[model samples]
Target: MLEKIFKLSENKTDVKTEVLAGITTFMTMAYILAVNPSILSAAGMDSGAVFTATALAAFVGTLLMAVLANYPFALAPGMGLNAYFAYTVVIGMGYSWEYALTAVFAEGIIFILLSVTNVREAIFNAIPKNLKSAVSVGIGLFIAFVGLQNAHIVMGGATLVELFSVDGYNKLNGVNATMNDVGITVLLAIIGILITGWLVVKNVKGNILWGILITWAIGIVCQFVGIYVPNAEVGCFSLLPDFSHGLSIPSIAPIFCKLQFKGIFTLDFVVILCAFLFVDLFDTIGTLVGVSSKAGMLDKEGKLPKIKGALLADALATTAGAVLGTSTTTTFVESASGVSEGGRTGLTAVTTAILFGLALFLSPIFLAIPSFATAPALIIVGLYMMTNITNIDFDDLSEAIPCYVCIIAMPFFYSISEGISMGIITYVVLNLLTGKAKEKKLSLLMYILAILFVLKYAFL
Candidate 1:
């Protein structure tokens, strides 16, 4: 049945491998189950309801990816988009959460139209092959930086960022943290990274999945022995899952289907909708390009087969997520963890979707998996994705310089879309000025994109 459904033999993968890949993907990205609710609640939404909405949105979106695209990708409320929804739109702009959601819903509708019209696929095909490779490498660095920050192995410092130090964290955050609360967990994360690296070197099956569970187990042991202490005020919590409240799903009635289109005709609403559309479009394209490239799923033309299905799935997921009462749902880059684990079919996405569905009822257990445990998986996956750098045409400065700019901008600017925007602009400008535009045969869509990005920076 699995073979018939996912063409497992054709993809050179089996059920065991795909399932493991799916679990690895879920473990790495499960942080969203906890994070989305926290961020959305800041926008005056109910946290419990948001948790339910997030889990349902992920389940619905990931399941759609499997059924529609048959690809090993997962979807959820995106990180940066959520922050903008909460902080910028709702709080900073003083708009109601309902109003913000209406913009996201409208953005999703536009994306669906774009996908149906093949505009998104055209943009994907229009990017230069070297820049596509650069996007993969850039995401590697971006996610690695994210892993470091998540584990508190990297923290804000006098010089902007620095290595983990107990005193430094204390001073920067104005909190009284100790080795038991902050220091030991960071040490464990470092150890987990080295251990996971060793497993990768030894060619262990399901190394990434095992790495997360092993890290969590070690934290549990540390907490048992008093080496690690749970400090609620400092964001540290018990490693053990708290099941005292029992297994029950939260109701989504509070925020579900609460869209407000009253003030959406204004300029401010258009800006918000455009922001969501721009970020979600590029981020999804960037992930599909990066992860698919690493998984060897792209054709010789540097394009993924059945890409319209993938884009349509993402488009539908974003629209569905808005209706479910969350921020923009998009393809998660952490799906690279699954691809690195040898996932090549929809079975992997189905497995991830099942986990998300289970999370609705088992929230405490899934949310108990801390960032420190998953951090190693992301760092290791980053290492895997970074190997794509060899595919770039370094001999050609016209290609190399923009690729370099794209690669550096992602982690430095802390945005995948920003990296792509800078890369496209630099790629078009450099090639045009150097008399290589005609030689490269850059498409008209590429020029339009560069101009659009330029206008985005100029005004928005």
Candidate 2:
């Protein structure tokens, strides 16, 4: 039955293929199953509640990707966006977690609205194909950046004296400014790069996963041999959600109700939402495109069927998370790993959904897996994502500007929205100046989006 459904002979997919795909998908994205709770834990929220929310979100989202879009894309609470949820909106912006949840809920609703209206499809068609690929790759780089920073792997560097420094530290400063920390981080990054090279050269299957596991194992053995200081919780795995602390959703929407809606009506929030929506939208599109390319699922009409259903699924997943107790529900890029493993169809997603469902019984095992071990996997994925940058046509400066702007500005601006804003504005300005405006894929909605960025950035 499984063989018949996946059409292994046609797609060369089989039980062994599904299991391999499932395992690949699992290894790449296993970090996500844990990352959601870790970020939420920082907000002093109940870990138990966070774990429950994360599992439910992953199960629902992944199933939708598999069953709805018929793609191998995985889903989970988004990484960078959730950090922004915790750090920027909640803490930095002085909104409570509840308000943040409300914003997430709103984003999901907007996603659904656009999808159902088929406005979402129109936008996807309007975007340059390279932009779609770049957005996905850009996000991959963004997530990888987060992983490295968390692992203390990427450090600031200079030509002389310190060469590479940790946290912008310099040795001439003081006693605590010793070079040991920087040394370790550089060493790890180097090993990671070397492993990546080895994988590329050998064309090894599961290179990223294998490299990550190898690095983690090395780190573990180093600790055992008394050569390394361990920052990880090294231990045996336990499979079950840690529901020790009672779970409760934060209720902060009343605060927004009490506050003036004056700012909300302004272009700032709207622009931000548009930016978020665009990234989320394109990210989903690229995943679908890439997976479709692999699975031979593209329609003869040169479109993906049930794409609207997939969008609605994502939007609903976000809403489900906000209510059930987590952050935004974005589709997982790691699901491509499943496709690579032989999961050509939704049955693979079904298996993943089942795993996530059972995960509620085993949250401890998931959480116990340290970020450092997972960091390696993310770094490798980032490398894959970085390859998309090459697709940008540099000979034509018009399209080149937005591509470079979005890529460079995302990490610099520290908000994907701001980066996208810069990209849009740059694109518009470049088109007008270069006399390529006629050739532009201009839409009324896009013009509104560009105008909003200027207002929000300059005046608001």
Question: Each prediction's Cα lDDT score?
Answer: 0.84, 0.64
Q: Candidate 1 at 29: error in angstroms? A: 6.7
Off by over 4 Å in 1: 1-51, 69-107, 202-206, 253-307, 325-352
Top-lDDT candidate index: 1
Candidate 1 local lDDT, residue 451 = 87
* Clash count, one per candidate: 0, 11
lDDT of 1 by residue, 167-200 (tens): 9999998999999998999999998998889877
TM values, all candidates: 0.76, 0.78
Candidate 2 Cα outliers beyond 4 Å, as residue runs = 1-20, 35-51, 66-73, 79-97, 155-213, 229-267
Clashing pairs in 1: none
lDDT of 2: 0.64
